[model samples]
Target chain A: MSDDKAGASPAAAYLAIDWGTTNRRVYVMAADGSVLATARDDRGIKSVEAGCWADELAGIRARFGDLPAIAAGMVGSTRGWREIPYVIAPAGVTELATGIGRIPEERFFIVPGVAYDTPDHADVMRGEEVQAVGACLSGLAPHDALFCQPGTHNKWIGLKDARITSVTTALTGELFALLRDHSILAEMMTGPVEDGPAFRAGIADAAGGDLLSRLFGVRASVLLGRRAREDGAAYTSGLLIGADVAAREVAGRLVHILSDPNLGPLYAVAIEAFGGTSTAIDGQAAFVAGIHHIWSMIDD
Target chain B: MSDDKAGASPAAAYLAIDWGTTNRRVYVMAADGSVLATARDDRGIKSVEAGCWADELAGIRARFGDLPAIAAGMVGSTRGWREIPYVIAPAGVTELATGIGRIPEERFFIVPGVAYDTPDHADVMRGEEVQAVGACLSGLAPHDALFCQPGTHNKWIGLKDARITSVTTALTGELFALLRDHSILAEMMTGPVEDGPAFRAGIADAAGGDLLSRLFGVRASVLLGRRAREDGAAYTSGLLIGADVAAREVAGRLVHILSDPNLGPLYAVAIEAFGGTSTAIDGQAAFVAGIHHIWSMIDD
Candidate 1:
């Protein structure tokens, strides 16, 4: 049986492109903000030459129908097609929509990222802002809550009254990858990382403080015949994730996590391990919902 | 004026080899533990083909006169000539001399590294142990005080009554190099790092906790135009060093820093910044003194 609407298909709306450095995901949305079709490819912003953004967009449009396009993420960074200024937090969808930059052709629009700036501290994010705003708009996250977005750069963002208030980013994923590939502990960590005893034990170890010391312990423990070599990766992962969680004030509070299938559950488990409750929201869904909300506000 | 003694050259005693993964430093010492000659080369344990250690030693003997050799560091590791078990902490020159492993030739001896193992935690070190012991034996360090040995694997050692009481290792230098060479923060960290405002600021930031987040801030601050790109490396260095120092209990005590000229003052500064006074001891001097002390006990 066809699962499509019983009547004619809904009219095609704008094409949403989550254009990142090495990959791009495009979603076709109907006028009612429902996704009609979606596709992903490796031809991200980095693959497109500076002057070939027009051709790139045309190719994407040709495959998904000639619809106006709205892109987010690195597509708006300095290295992307055109630089888009970042809107400062305490911002929500309304501010983000206003800060959106458009190409001269007027057919493609790029969303601005968000920045948290202080005299002594500053942080910036491009693609994750859209997903965060979407989570708030979709009611998946409360107006005043903490959201954990885990990735190469894990972001712990705060929202107040439906607007992003603060942003704290951790280099957990990047550091983990760097250590796995290039560190002295690399050889021992060539094993699968799962949520098991070793991982939980690592989380427990993180509470003891001194991450750099703990990192070396990964190698030391194995060398001492106290820990299996295979569990090094999982334990290190737990230690990093645990440190990321423990650094926050998450005692007796709920955290909303926006992530993919792989990192979402892990982050949720880490939050629970650190005495906090969390709910995982699909990242792609949040991005699409966020874009749709912005579309409705602007397309009209 | 001749710098050497006017009499006949002192009889060749033992050749102390600080053997490591990529480089080796050898010192020819007199019976009194005074260095008669010193040289360094790249024929480290890694470069020597397996099962060719005898030939490798022969080559070294060919360069210097055939003398009994005492080796330390990775030379005694599993991948080296022969694996030597590590001695437990609360050890001193006496324990190290007793735990020394010897080759079949009887002319070659390897100093065992030190290990701090508890039911909940474990830490190990190779060449640094010899240096720490030397610092104590040479009267460069107090018997009951903290010692910070900074290097690729920074070690914080505690000594009580001329014996090693505790050991904690941090991957500060290794992680700094890894991030500077590979992480996203690499681009901005191309400039030279020195003792400056940026470095001190990084050390100060480390006191706030959440090192992973602070690491990301190294990049975020630059991207947000709040920090100069050139200062990124120094700032990051300060952060890692600061974190390493803060993790220890050095509020009001004196820390003896065993390090080279480059890292010695830096660690001293970091320790002072973290509310501790510190004294810097020459690393090579400490190593030679340590080996000499051990040799005096063993050769007798």
Candidate 2:
């Protein structure tokens, strides 16, 4: 059904918002947690004027008639519409839902991200916590599992008994993009995102040695005419993902990869090359499912 | 002595040219290997128009007469004035000199870079091979040693029997520049290029884990208020260098770091932090000495 028609229905339930730095997605769900309609726009938290989050929520309410809304992602960041304190790990949906911060007068609340503190370092994640929660609730994740959410910041998370115990962020995708666009290696790469032999070769190359030294091979191989120029992108992708997987030492473990469509296959291939098995989950569906799960946990 | 005065001297020995991608330096040397005068400009190989190598050499000849000139670095690459095929390692000054490509009638020749081949990978170095030869001839490098020439591409060379046996290129410096100027971490950094505790901390952080994950800590630490934004550059440098050192497993060994003044101290510090000792050699002096050494080996 159309969003307006769903909004007009007496059965219209709750509004779920996945609000990140670059895009905003809203889902209309019935009381039973099934999505009825969805809407999205480029008005991410970064583009919204400061102190205007309330007004922005008001506009959304105007269309959906004041349905109670729950938001996730960077919308709760310092640079976002509001700054919500992080819920420390090992934390589950209950802790995350309980940490939600409400707008002063609106029927809107923001989901708090999860943070982990090790003896040597600390890490924090915003929207991915929602995805983790969704994965657990949707039964895609096991009681004890390793989850990899690959994107600009690829996160490898350790979950136990539905609680996120650890989080590690890899700058794989960002580094790949940076090198592809700016590094000397950029001159050699051809398009259509290479995937077969060149990519597997990259993964194999990443199996040993320090990544700092290995990265230069991308340029060196092409310059030496040892590898085809068209294979540059795949080689780079394999190198990054391979290094990441190797560092994690995920051998023999089943890794659940939650990634956008484009990156899912690459991570899966790399994981297998590194002696691990992985299953890919749709990121957007997991994101929406996560929001719905968290929204259901919040008390009126 | 002034360049013109030295050019007029009958005692003028030979010419040494260190031509890289961004800058070019020419040295007039006495027969005894002392530098009589030096000149430099931004007219590196990259700036020189195609087929203009002869014109460029002629302009220098007009100023310095018919003194035989030996050039090294990017000037011999495909993009340079002439393409000199790489001399395979285990190679030394004599081998490099023998591979020098001459310009038809001009008293000028280009030094060939050294290349290393492994069953799995290939690597090549141009100007630094000259410095490696210089380091050996100058007695700064041991018969068997690990040499690090730090710059855009940091080369870790294994020298034995006065020959470069192995070559590993680390893109540490280039990666640092990319992140410092373009990544999200750039917004948080204020620099005088940090060199103290933060740098050491970054090195320590790199001791374990993949670089892809460790790099993200630079941003997360700042956002979490654990580190000052100003320390970002040092932290990044430490992370890259530390990862490089740790990966090489160079503990307890003496590393000869041939670097420009600015990068020398930083590397020395990182090496010490990682349980190794290092000696910093001036890169430019080494370059000129390398050119002279190779030139002396060329037959009349």
Candidate 3:
């Protein structure tokens, strides 16, 4: 059951696994980098607190046949299979391959997450920083570019000369959830976003100045008749979303590495607010490229 | 039962009431404007709804002997005794005066609420608007200023030349409640407010950028090792209050405001974020001044 010889020969395949605290994903690629097949499991590091990384990888190999199963994420945490300390933000794919193996001397490269530990704060980027760096390469940009990956936790990473030098995280999506589901703003809001006037209005309200006083209008607008109660949820959602978009430096002459176009409007809002240049790229695609880039680095 | 004689005579005692949506307060005052006695009750309009205004007021009077009582809030709503039409914004104190009544030929005044009608929106202010306006006249400079009243519902009111010109509301207080009480943010914040690092961190996080993003940080910070989960409520509160304060004009030269100081450090936050002259006044003291100011404006 070895994927290395699943199709024909021993040198035909390589495995890439993105394993994290809560989930695991793996891709077996042919010599030319085409995905030969795939495997996924819920046996993330957090769930399988015991030594299940080997079992999980074995399961994937049983399905796709065994190959060099490289990995990333919490599999390398202090509590992970092997403690691979995160590479500093300025490190490149060069580090993702430097010390990667199921056990050293094997033909596998475990990607290193990026970490930033300053005097006042500490942050980590498990798998996406590499993807972001790879995305810049996908777009044929220079070694350096501005990378934006939006999700529950949105990261604005600065890549200088192909190295992720620094990054900032924004919790825009989570904020929307709290505001709509947790605040008095909830009373006014309903589900599923029927109208966008409140959303647009929130964006406009957040545009120029005064975050608090303008916030007063969210309630006042509804209570005082500026908006309807049902629109309240959307308005409140927009309030936080609009504020997040407003507070960030999304627009400036640079390539923005967004996850997808669904997050486009958010970045578009940032561009509109700051008068900056932005480009959207696929996060998953970047992940693939970053995997290959790491392989290239390792093989070189 | 009759303040008519007292109204006609210089020595007659008069009662002023700041009956609001959820709480009732009464002040027995001498003809010279000194408070002789004060009491409060839970029979505010919200407790009984609009149709029960008369019965509620009668109960309030029952607690403190039959006396001439001036009432405000829903008592003037369509649900209360009479539908006091809202006076236009920028209207005089005389304009906000509603349900002003007197015995046949006697003198007494029931303060009126104000209202504004605009092409896109309309607003109305009941009981507290009078007090806030009174605060504007009695305690503030004789010019235009914003009044910040924080509570279950926070109000940002504008005054022109010591008169209540217009008003807006922010549900910062209520938002704090909903977020703390119902939302998942509560699970992580299963304790009393530290009001120290947690609260300040919230303010800083919220103050850092778009509210939604900051809001998202509340959950992710906990999930991602950036912030403590127990601090979620305080941080959420700060994010909202910060958004509330940021909503209006906090910059430029003439943005002076009178705010209640008991709102923890939010006053300083307002001052720091909004920037201009601000005096953190006591809400309890202002309540007295509010009653006096409105009563003084009563036409005798």
Candidate of highest lDDT? 1
Candidate DockQ scores, in order: 0.89, 0.77, 0.30
Per DockQ, the best of the predicted structures is 1
Instruction: Write the residue-wise lDDT of candidate 2 on A150-222 in tens digits.
Output: 8888998888987889988888888988998889878765544656998888888888846777788877887
Candidate 2 Cα errors over 4 Å, as ranges:
A1-5, A62-65, B1-5
iRMSD of prediction 2? 1.3
What's the best-to-worst order under lDDT? Answer: 1, 2, 3
True contacts kept of 1: 0.94
TM-score of each: 0.95, 0.95, 0.72
Residue pairs of candidate 2 with colliding backbone atoms: none
Error of 1 at B96 (Å): 1.0
lDDT by residue (B10-91, candidate 2, tens digit) is 7788888888999988888888777888888898888999977788888887787668888888999999988999999999
Error of 2 at A191 (Å): 3.4
Ranking by DockQ: 1, 2, 3
